[model samples]
Target: MQLPLFPLNLYLLPGGISKLRIFEPRYVRLVKLAMASDDGFGLCMEVNDNICHFGTRVIITDFDQMPDGFLGITIRAMDKFVINHQWQEEDGLRFAQTSVLPNWTPTEIKYIDRDLSQGLQMLFDEYPEHAAYYPQPDFEDMAWVCQRWLEILPLGTEQKQWFMSRNDHRAALSFLHSIIDEELKDK
Candidate 1:
């Protein structure tokens, strides 16, 4: 299926939220059409001035007119997808045919981990508005916890694509452990 693309240099995982402010006529039209349909638009990252190979399917959860008069919308990423074919539309919105990427299975958080849970809380504490965008954090699911962390980190699209291609998030968890260890040493 051909879907409109919203390109940004950002990593968004399943269960992640993207708050967008749309003022462009094409985007405003895309938002309106997506809101009226069940299947939403394609959200692809712009890598080196081109659309990244990977993307996510987004479902509009909330919408409003911003104080600056722009159309504001919050969308939740549902699944990972890779672009198959793409082209520009007459309206200037790019459209792409994508195939869904394999998803990670949720793993139970076997033990309490402050780095995973408390770190997220600290983030929310510093940026209170973000707490409102997501439903309560999933402290019980290791995959959920790890994916959220990955989304927050500043990594290149290539690095992110590598991580996503892995069989599971055990590698991600190991890397995260090293970061948390260093953080503890600093404290």
Candidate 2:
């Protein structure tokens, strides 16, 4: 499970899609490789010198040259993974050995999760640009709901890594409650 790595604070969950601008020479090469191969690269969350073990394996779904002439690409997150080892090339492109994690089974969005549910709808309404990336959202799935929220919330990298490392997502759900509650208090 060797992969090319791109370390950014951005995270994408399984079934998530995001657009990225490729200008750095190293990343440009990495994007090309991901696009050309069936196996795509890993998107790691960079926290200081250490990258979070949890990451998403992404494949380029679309590509274009931006008006400014830099490469623009839209990637779809295929699945989650944990990095086992890593290294960098002379040009600074990061690569790693990863273990692909199991996809969560979908569950009906429960009543207790309505706030998490509404928050996403409010988000899409407020940020139409973010809404435009995902053509259809699987809001019925609790796993989908939690993962999407986890990606958007401004949680610390260590906290994010801690939540992501667990086999189940109960911790993430509770974390979301605190965040959603904080937002509710402000309004």
Model 1 residue 12 lDDT score: 79
lDDT of 1 at 142: 83
Which runs of model 1 end up more than 4 angstroms from their true locations?
Answer: 112-114
Q: In candidate 2, what are the lDDT values of residues 1-187, reduced to their tens digit?
A: 8999989888787888899999999999998888778999998898676777799899998899999999998988988899889998999998999998887677788898887888887888899998898778877777888888887888788777776676666777788888878978998
User: In candidate 1, what are the lDDT values of residues 84-107, reduced to their tens digit?
Assistant: 999988988888998887677898
Candidate 1, position 154, lDDT? 86
Candidate 1 local lDDT, residue 14: 85
Please estimate how well model 1 matches the true structure, expressed as its whole-model Cα lDDT.
Answer: 0.82
